[model samples]
Target: MIFDCLLTADAAWLGGRELAGPTAIGVREGEIGWIGPLPAAPDATHREHIEGVLLPGLIDYHVHAALIQPEKLLAAGVTTVMDLGWAPAEIWPLVERARHDPGLPRIHAAGPFLTAPGGYPSRQPWAPPLVAIEVDDPAAARRAVEALVAHRPATIKITLNSQAGPVVDDATLHAIVRAADAHGIPVTAHTQGSGQTRRAQLAGVRVLAHTPWTEILDDRLIADLARDTTIISTIDIHGWGEPSPDREIALQNLRRFHSAGGVVRYGTDLGNGPLPLGVNTREIAALTEAGLSPTEVLDAITGAPLRPGAPADVSVVPGDPIANPAVLGQAGAVLKGGQNVTDSDGGG
Candidate 1:
């Protein structure tokens, strides 16, 4: 491969283990070509040795891309982001920009939130028209999934919240899941209320957009979820600041979910409310409260490869092991597609 920049460092947590020795990674065509110990420098070779840690491109499983511009995400060390909910028409242009712009965050979108006729986002003041599709029947549910898939959505999102009014019925929810699965795309649902959670589980949804906090899940539900789907942690976005009822519910549900060995992903639900644009420290602290150690939390964010069809180059913070959960959001440094963007500012 034709290489451009070379970065050498002490030890980096490249997901699994701490890589030893001076490592050199080759970047070509905006992707990692080769990564290993530093090779002997050729005569007059050009490279930029980033001073701090090198982590895999951080992936925020949940985020609204519009909340934070792509440039800011890249500068802050987030290379890839999953826009959980947004107007596809408005977001398409930004996705195009990221696709071509080397200095911007790589974008993947869910198109919009699939909801019932009078669902949660329907009445929200901030909800964009292009961001939510209201489906009240099985046919409409199928159509919604097909529409999102037509836009080449990475996954499907369904809103099943009673608080928002007229929630999707079990048949419609199942139809959405079936349609998504038929196209080989997993369905992620914004499930709320005790009945809704149990219904979503029964429908074989691939992921719960957030931990079910409206009510505590029983052992049966947790075990069922642990075996079938991954739950994303938007725990910090629950209460924002004070100890409210929602926050308490989320914490309790997360505790049970983690104990059941359910797959968890670190997400801040950025742009949902008043959360920080970048990695939120409060999010990590909440994970710790749910029984995730620093290592487990790291694994959740900087974990293994996602989307086998679209592989992403991974690297991680080089040093200053995240002993304290409070500082987990302090991106030590970063390496994405073999390119070091954080330099030494990652604080080792």
Candidate 2:
């Protein structure tokens, strides 16, 4: 059968974890229909031979999708983004738009942060009043979760930033986790301050929006966290464009966490600082410094495998990213749902 598009690469990163040499992939009906050796089909409607590495498009585990244009992400090889926090009224529309538009990165969002009264982001200048839901008690936490669940958030985001202000009490934190669990939704916490990481783990938070940077985590706690929670690496945000104590602490903690078999995913906290629109190389370098091997680093960003029946989202870069992570920032070609969003020259 004839396919809609065919992409052949000198080497393909299968699931971003292993390499397959001289591979070809066929796209049909917006899904990968075939993957094998080069020249699998000579009569496909469209075909392109990539003189580089082909891999699944990147997934940024944390970002504010509403604050940036999706096309920027698409151009940079990100095909999906998990938006950690935003106003539901404003973000849901972007998610819906992304779902229907193949040219945009798919957006999964957690609307409004659940925090204590007058807590963290509510007082931050960049965060508007509506960006945080203030909960003072278990009942309030339940109500807040219920309200957010109505919007069908991809996950629940809770602020445990005791350094900034009064944080959600343990009772309230537990309530939020329980409520989210009842709805089959995972909870992600922005853990900060001493012991906050341990608190989040105890409360059954499934993910940390950012790797805890304020304190060095003990090995025992790191092991425990590794057993269940997945940490999104927003280490570069601590430094912005320069190194700082926070960056140092984050790198140390992450190194220990990874050594103990912790799960780490790439996330830049894009809208919070001077982060790039997509594929922050600084974040990649930070993860490398934190002891992640090249393969692990690639797997962190390419969250899912490219297999038959998966969405036809792929990134073609001119060099082996495993050899040089910085090459990831330069996409030779990008495809979303079987359609070419950018060509080998990095132009749409």
Candidate 3:
């Protein structure tokens, strides 16, 4: 069958390794139909020659859309972003837009912040109305989870920020987790201050929205978390480029977390501060500092490989991304589900 588009790259990243290519990737019916060397490539209606490397679409595992525009993300080569907290009413339209528009990065949204009454973001001046669904007890927590499940989020987000305000009680936190689990949904938390990480861990949270930064985590807890939980690396949120004690503590904590084999996904708490909206080089630098090898770094920021039948989601990043980490922040071309969304000038 003649595919809709054929992409030939200088090289390609597949299965955690970079293969020297004249790699040919075919897209048809909004999915990848074939991947092989050019010598064995299938016929296509059109060919897009990539003078750069082809890699799976990058994913920023944590972001909040309240302050940033979605179009910028696609241009930055980020084809997907997980928005951890937003008012479902405020965020759902954007998520729906992304689903139908290749020009926007797909959003895997975690509906809203489920927190204690008057907790955290609700008190932050910048939070939109109803950005959180606050609960005071186990029963209330379950109901909030039920409400969120109806919206069909990628995961449920709970805020347990002792440093910011009153946190969800253990019973309530457990109820939220149990309720979400019953429906096959995982819980991701924004944990802060002492013991909140452990509380979330003990309550069966599956993902942490940010690496813990308020204090250094104990080794035993880090090891235990590594066995089951994944951490979203938002290390640059502390100060971006400036020095801060919080940044130092978070770096040390993440260093140990990595040593203990904790899974990390690249995330910049975009919109929270003056973070670079997409493909944050600062965040990548911090990840490298935390000891992630280039391949692992690529894996953390990108989705699965270009296997046949996968969504035709990929990007052309300039230069050898593994050799020159800075190139990962820029895109020459980007395709989301087989539709070229890169700028007309080929700037992603």
lDDT of each: 0.72, 0.87, 0.87
TM-score of each: 0.88, 0.94, 0.96
RMSD of each: 3.6, 2.2, 1.6
Which candidate order results from sorting by lDDT in descending order?
2, 3, 1
Candidate 1 achieves a global lDDT of 0.72
Per-candidate total of colliding backbone pairs: 9, 0, 1
Candidate 2 lDDT by residue in tens digits, 121-161? 89987786498999999999999999988888999999999
Error of 3 at 109 (Å): 0.6
Could you give me the TM-score of model 3 versus the true structure?
0.96
Candidate 1 runs further than 4 Å off: 17-21, 39-45, 305-318, 322-328, 332-336, 339-348
Q: Identify the candidate with maximal TM-score.
A: 3
